[model samples]
Target chain A: MTKMHMVSALNNALDIAMKADDKIVILGEDVGVDGGVFRVTENLQKNYGEQRVIDTPLAEAGIVGCSIGMSLNGLKPIPEIQFSGFSYQAFHHIKQHMARIRQRTNNTMSCPMVLRAPCSGGIRALEHHSESPESFFIHCQGIRVIMPAGPYDAKGLMLAAIKSEDPVIFLEPKKIYRSFKEDVPEEAYEIELDKANVRKQGTDLTMISWGAMTRLCEETIEDLEKENISVEHIDLRTLWPLDINTLSNSVNKTKKCIIVQEATKSCSLSSEISAQINERCVLNLEAPIQRVTSWDLPFPQFALENYFLPNKTRIKNAVKKVLEF
Target chain B: MAQEQIGQFGINHVSILDKEGNVDEKLASGFTKEQLSEMYYYMNLLRKFDEKLFNLQRSGKIGTYAQTKGQEASEIGSGLALSENDWFVPSFRELGVYLTRKVPKNLLVQAWNGDTRALGNPNHSHNLPISIPIGSQCIHATGIAWASQIKQEKDVTIVYFGEGATSEGDFHEAMNFAGVFNLPIVFFCQRNGWSISTPTTKETKSETIAQKAIAYGFKGIQVDGNDVLAVNKVTTQAIEKARSGDGPTLIESITYRMGDHTTSDDSMKYRTQEEINEWENKDPVLRFEKYITNNNILNEQEKTDIHNAIEREIQEAVEQGLSVEKPNPEQMFEDVFAQMPEMLKEQKEELLNEIIQMSEQNNNGGNQ
Candidate 1:
């Protein structure tokens, strides 16, 4: 095992996959020569040559649409949309073709491609660079949506997403791209899709979150444990095809739950999780489920970003409310 | 400073066969009698199939279908130029291409009837399923060609779209990629005069759709879409150039939409009868039929036999399409993923149990 950050871990994942399969090709804006905007694909073009690692023109729809074509013709293409906010330009291709090709063709043609984008806020970057669009992709059918919080899970999930037969929307939280380091395995490994990780176990309250918010939840759980409140913290590594079984089991044991997310409160993944928990573990619940999320406005600019995002105070307050109820 | 011309480009228009069934003998000499007869047969077959589909929709046997009436030459000529190894990526209105590629007639019927099984296996046939969103398949064709280039394969990819597609950003992006990579692809554009209710003149003011390729650093040519010989000649030359690594070519075939945009449309509301009459005089199928007769490529007896055979084949296809069983509800859960996740499995099971419970309730009520 070696210590690495999220960017290095993701780059290692790409290197390993490309070395194992010649059919794997990476293409996007600035992916070659410059590695990537976040340098997640550094040294890939140098190692794989320009053919396998392409530097395409600045057209998101073309990048995604062409990748769909490449995947259709027997190549496993991983196309990166520069930012999650700009993915809307390619949303037509993603929602219409990439997600439905297999079902539309009755399994005759499947798109085994992965679309990578750096998502969520806290980077203090320009507008459109800090938006969380996981809920948009989770609502789409026939595609897997994944978001990995740390270096270890990033490498494992990236490899699994590359090997998956179905199309995957891999959302990398840019805020933590290089914020911290972890001892990740050197060899290839796969963390199964549609499975959540139990970061810490407790019997008092259950806190569910994903992406960068999971790190905040970890800190909050540390503080709560010191205050004599036991909390079960779960990181939803895969957003779609959710591991509801794990969630229900944890909620049943804790009997109080709080969902934290970076996206707006309306029609987000948190809403879905809250509704599912209410349906499945309502009888076991000791209090009403609380959701701590960003307000239902457009993601604010950098000045108000910290205020807009769910902070530790907000999460602890939600936890207190659920416990007291 | 003095002003000078930076670049000069010219677009060429090709028309070897005329409306009067006369051809420039030298330009048409490359085609054998068999090839000419085959092209004529496909054109006739497409027209017949188109009429039958119209009747089927009228009788409520199938859903709305986009007809391929006057553009038969544009579809069949370019389709026949392709080798089986080459890919045929098409927009929704190329039934003639499917016929040329030997896609089953029953599958075509089923596709129009909204059956999923009609998509067939694209890997086996080297043809993509019809794209409905308009102009999106061009980029796919470029990517396929790019893949072939990367693998150092000689296979070329040919993509078909309509005139209105030229106005789309995807079309321009596809052209740019083909130019930049020098990929082996042919952008076959059918200038079918109308995109639904809107005419081509309103879609773009570029004088001709073929010239758009010049900006992308490639050759663009306009062919009389009603002239099967000209379309065949240009497409053949374009495919050869692509195979030889000469890069992509854009061929604009000029034709008219002889029918409505689809069964759901009424062309009479927007188009004048006189304009329709003018195009009807230059019908592609009639022109090809006359050419075959004038050249002695097919005799009257042979023509009658071909028609009779086509009628029988259409009948069999209709029967086969109609006789297909309704798909099981559980089949919907399949193909969404390579492996059904536990969540989906539970949902499928719940749906099945719900169906069973409803049936059981009905049975108990009947006994009471």
Candidate 2:
């Protein structure tokens, strides 16, 4: 009903979910009073009271671990990790326990919790603030990982994540928290977490990206068109339990493809997707799938952050390279 | 950001009831006599069931078993501390504790038999599934406690581990989170003096596990774990503190793992028989029996009947748990999702058909 930014959309989604379910709790560091470092949880405590909106001490493992317990105890917990890069501190819970909990307990129990982290680079923030790490979660089976490309996607994906019976990792694009605004509906709606959305249509090439990278892809197409390159764009909202049919159909049409992720270029999630594409559509390929990703280096300081991240120019160059091939 | 420690731990020990069945005026008993007797009876059941399982293992009826014999006081005492709605997150060896919480005896047997489907969740009671990974339960317990407080639920939580589990990173993280947030949790560490072959002397340089709480800004206490009365009293106080919203407490019950670490281990490889004998003399169950008998609380006939009753009950549980039908191979893949995806369904059908064909081929070969 109103034009909201990405963070505002998230706040609205959480507020709506919590208001509907008494068992739902919002937990994380500074999420209660300060409303998160980015204000995504702004005014939640004032509305729900301290019992529902909790500000936990800074420990990623504890946040995720406890959320699992809360979920088992009949509460729907929405946990915040402050930033995506810091999630490495909780790999034990995520890799060993988070997804395996239901399997560990013979499906007698499940971690019906959602972990919210601000992912992807471009905000020019500190080193760890803007890194994308969805691949680690994508590799996990029982758990679902997702990211939103815009305000509408953020609200819809968050609502879906909260409603899911299994544990979910909802990665928010931090750089775009306030960058764009859209008319998010007042009536609650859920965009399926496993379905991918095609942002634009073209036959020359299909550029795939998610999170903040989708915005850059849109910009890249704008410049690529100046040179008369009509490109297709696929925004993958959810990474795990992927909507492969969407990618296959799009790739089948375009033949040429480029995968742009803000995370590192090594054996990342994009590698898995590329392998899947090659296996499924090998005959239709016009060239090898190209990846425009960050280098395999620790996220550098903000001073050198620009070089560590992929920008519009990088995506355009990747498109040019794919087209030339 | 933190508080100061009063003194080093292991120097002070707590006890409430005496060997003569007299309650200490200085230490208050939290529960009535009826509740105390119920807890004592559960401990007796645990002891009898443990003996049965150990015998089963020795006779080749079951696989390796973890005997929770001498540590009954620690497990039962802590188990009784939780209210109906509270959670008891425990490690695998706390069989005595798990029994009190209704962890289906059959499921326990099924899990030990290597059938993953037999594993149950903490839903059996307000407790969690038995955690095999050391010290991992503490973080889960803290999480549940945090959620309870965050959701304004009246339920508190208790977590069980051993002295050796303190070394894990998750343990430190658990304490750090509980301390900072003032979470409602009771941390019970059964200091059984040894973790497998590693002795407490080399576990850590810290004087006492209880004192570790002081470093994290919480109250810590040491109790005579073999003294059933003391374990009950100390656990009650710590659990009550958590229930009242004062936050967590670290309780170190100084006991010994009177038997081998597990049925698969050999204590003789590392420890002396004389030490085991010394601990056997301090058996919590026998001492409590003596305390009650000496006071003329029960005649010899009554004691005999109690033992016979517990044996009969344990035998029934064993028979029932073993009698349950074995899980089907088809059901092994269930519960992963409410609705299995098409790929998993396809894979399951393929595996089942392959199994059928393989069986048919063997039958045909036998006929030929």
When only the first chain is scored, the TM-scores of the models are 0.99, 0.97
- lDDT tens per residue, model 1, B1-368: 99999988899999988888888999988999889878878998999999999999999999999999999999999999999899999999999999999998988999999887788555455789999988999998898898888889899999999988998899999999999889999999999999998999899999999999999999999999999999989999999999999999999999988999999999999999999999999999888887889888899998898898899999999999878986677877887888988888999999999889888989889642
Superposed by TM-score, candidate 2 places the C-alpha of residue A247 at a distance from the truth, in angstroms, of 1.7
TM-score of each candidate structure, all chains considered together: 0.98, 0.89
Off by over 4 Å in 2: A226-228, A312-325, B1-12, B16-41, B55-64, B121-125, B150-152, B176-182, B330-332, B338-343, B346-350, B364-368
Every model's Cα RMSD, please?
1.7, 3.8
Provide per-model DockQ scores. Answer: 0.72, 0.47
The value of fnat for model 2 is: 0.56
Per-residue lDDT, model 2, residue B323, is 73
| Lowest-sum lDDT 10-residue window in model 2 chain A | A121-130
**Mind giving the per-residue lDDT tens digits that candidate 1 earns over A1-325?**
9999999999999999999999999999999999998998899999999999999999998999899988988899999999999999888888888888888788888889999999999988898888999888888888899999999999999999998999999999998899999999999999988999999999999999999999999888888889999999999999998899999999999999999999889999999999999999999999999999999998888999999999999998998898888
For model 2, residues A24-90, the per-residue Cα lDDT tens digits are: 8888889999999999999999999887888887788878887777787778989899998899888
